[model samples]
Target chain A: MFRHVVLFTWTEETTDEQKATLAAELAKLPGAIPEIRAFTFGPDAGVNPGNQEFAIVADFDNVEDFLVYRDHPVHQAAIAEHIKPIAASRAAAQFVFQA
Target chain B: MFRHVVLFTWTEETTDEQKATLAAELAKLPGAIPEIRAFTFGPDAGVNPGNQEFAIVADFDNVEDFLVYRDHPVHQAAIAEHIKPIAASRAAAQFVFQA
Candidate 1:
């Protein structure tokens, strides 16, 4: 399986309502896109001082499927409408798990 | 369960050998620290241009257990001896999984 992880640091001006909207939009991806095998996302618990405010962990069958999810119109729309405006920074990684 | 995710961008000067060593040392954590419920780490596949070089997703029973693993001597030693030296940047997040 291939895993895609993204950590997002929200801008100071971002409101709680906006954050909830982002999370709701993100949660809709699995149903909206067939390529996503599994999806999990949530607000950071703030136990770690250096942690980003939000995180997503999604799984796909392979890199091809991951790309499909990445470039899907629904995902793109979420980025443009919800994520991009409030996100101050994003850190992402993709990897294949042999086991 | 509580999940701790960390994304790492390695310095340009960091060698592949160093990265491999870091992965190997990280793999030893579950055995060294009983608090760790699950651990996964690997190099990014580079399918995504914005991806960091490496990522880790570790799970624990709760935040307190995650902290035990995070601050354990073995984990701290590995960070000091291996991870800290070569890592250019780090993005992290901690969250609880309800389901």
Candidate 2:
């Protein structure tokens, strides 16, 4: 499977409500995008200090499937309308592994 | 389960051999640390430009199990001996979700 993991640092001004909304929006993606094999995401659990504020881990069968989810209108809308507005910094990586 | 996602940007001085060593070293963790439920990691697949250089996604049954993996001497040694030297910047987040 191909896994795409994204780490986000929220802006100081980002509110809890905004983060919650983003989470809710993200939770709906697996239902809307069939290419997504598995998806899990949430805010930091506070286990460590100085960690990124949020993370999303999505899995697909291959790069093509991942690309489908990447370009899907619903995912794009969520990023543009919700994610980009409050994100201070974003770091992402895509890698493949045996399932 | 509690999921830990970490993103790392490699220093320019890092070499392919070093990265391979890191990957090999990380592969041993699941066997050494019983708390690890699932682990997947690799260098960036070049699907997206300007992404972090590498990522590791690990899962545990709960925060306590995750903490065991986090503080395990073998895992810590891998970080100090391999990861810390080449990593220019690191961003991490731990979160929970249903299995």
Candidate 3:
């Protein structure tokens, strides 16, 4: 499998409503994009101080499948409409692994 | 479950041997600390540019279990001995979700 993980730090101006919207939008992706084998995302639980504010962890069958999800219109729309505006800093890693 | 995701960007001077050592050390944590329910980590696959170099994703039953793994001497030692030396930047997120 190929795993893609992203961490985002929200801008100070970002609102709770926007975050909620992002989550809602993301929750719909797996249904819309069948290439996604597994997906999990949420706001940080604050168990550790000074950590990123949100996370998205996804798994795909291979790099090609991951690319399909990456370029899917629904995913692109979510990123442009909900994620881009509030994102302050973002860090991501994509790697192949066996489940 | 509580999930912890951490990303690391290696320093310019970091070598392959150091990263391998880090991975080897990290692979031992699940055995040493029983609280970890799931763990996956690897160097980035270069699917995207300007992304972090490495990722670690872990799951625990709850916040307390997550904390136990976080503060475990073996984990701390791995961080101190392998991770800290080569890491140029780090970003992490810990969140809760139903598995």
User: Which of the numbered candidates is closest to the native, going by highest DockQ?
Assistant: 2
Candidate number with the higher DockQ (1 or 2): 2
Interface RMSD of 2: 0.5
Q: Which stretches of candidate 3 lie over 4 Å from their true place?
A: none
Q: On a 0 to 100 scale, what is the lDDT of residue B84 in model 2?
A: 93
Q: Write the per-residue lDDT of candidate 1 for residues B33-78, one digit (tens) a residue.
A: 9988878788999887878999998889999999899889999999
Q: How well is each residue in A1-99 modelled by candidate 2, as lDDT tens digits? A: 999999899899999899889989999999999999999998899999999989899999999999999999999999999999999999899999999
B34-96, model 2: which lDDT tens digit per residue? 999999999899989999999999999999999999999999999999999999999999999
Per-prediction DockQ, in order? Answer: 0.79, 0.94, 0.89
Top TM-score hit:
3
Docking class of 1: medium
Two-way lDDT contest, 1 vs 3, winner: 3
Q: What fraction of correct interface contacts does each candidate retain?
A: 0.73, 0.96, 0.85
Candidate 1 chain B minimal-lDDT segment of 10 residues: B90-99
Q: Write the per-residue lDDT of candidate 1 for residues A1-99, one digit (tens) a residue.
A: 898999999899999899989888888999999988878888999887877999998889999999999899999999999999999999999988754
Q: Best to worst by TM-score, what's the order?
A: 3, 2, 1
Specify the poorest-scoring 10-residue window by lDDT in model 1 chain A.
Answer: A90-99
Off by over 4 Å in 1: none
Give one digit per residue, the lDDT tens place, for model 3 in A1-99. 999999999999999999999999999999999999999999999878899999999999999999999999999999999999999999999988779
